[model samples]
Target: MITKIAQIEILPGQEDAFEKAVTEALPLFLAADGCDGVDLQRSVEHPSRYRLMVRWETVKHHTVTFRASDAFTRWRALAGPHFAAPPKVEHVYPVLAH
Candidate 1:
């Protein structure tokens, strides 16, 4: 599997609401084709920053399939308003595991 890591930045005072929106959108990610798991993590030194990690069967599942789905539209609708800037997204494969 591959993982998509999205570095998100929310408006200064919208962190809570942004977190809530992502929480609410969990089901969307879970239900998506090729999606294995999803998680959101807050930065220790950057309160307005977050990382959205989603495991996918392949990169195309996220970049092509999911991006073209209605769920993606809904996700953006739910969380887009709080974005301070466009998210920085990348997909990576596991290089090592204990």
Candidate 2:
């Protein structure tokens, strides 16, 4: 599986609204093609900073398929306004525990 992480920094004082929006948009992420799951996590040291973690079956499932679909448009519409800047996103694979 591929893990996609989006590093987002919210606008000042918009944390609550942003969180609510993200919660409401969870289904969009889940409904994407090859999507496994997604999690929105807030930073303890930086209240306005968030990391959006999404698991997909492949990197292209997220980068190409999802990004080209309406869900991506909807996702941006929901969370784009609150962003301090465009998110820094990347995909990764899990490391072996052993």
Candidate 3:
């Protein structure tokens, strides 16, 4: 599996707006082809920071398939204004497990 993590720092007072936008935009992932699941979380220490953790069957599923889809564009457009800056995204692989 592939994991994609997006860390976003939202503008101070725009937290509520960003949350609302993410809630409304969550459904777009339902149609994604290789998506296993996705979760959005807010940091307890820094409420204005959020994380989007996505699990995909393959890296291509996100880098190519999802990224190239119209849904992605819509998602971006809808959430773009809520961001304090462009999100920093990272792709990772699990190396060890308990």
All candidates: TM-score: 0.98, 0.96, 0.92
**TM-score of decoy 3:** 0.92
Error of 3 at 81 (Å): 0.6
Q: Give the TM-score of candidate 2.
A: 0.96
RMSD, every candidate, angstroms? 0.5, 1.0, 1.1
| TM-score of model 1 (CA atoms) | 0.98
> For candidate 1, lDDT tens digit of each residue in 14-47?
9999989998999999999999999899999999
The Cα local distance difference test for each model comes to 0.96, 0.94, 0.89
lDDT of 2 by residue, 1-98 (tens): 98999999999999999999899889998989999999889999999999999999999999899999998898889989999999999998988856
Per-residue CA lDDT of model 3 for 1-98, tens digit only, reads: 98999999998999888888887777887679888888999999999999998898888999999999998998898788989899999998899978
RMSD of 3: 1.1
Give lDDT for model 2. 0.94
Q: Which run of 10 residues does model 3 get worst, by summed lDDT?
A: 22-31
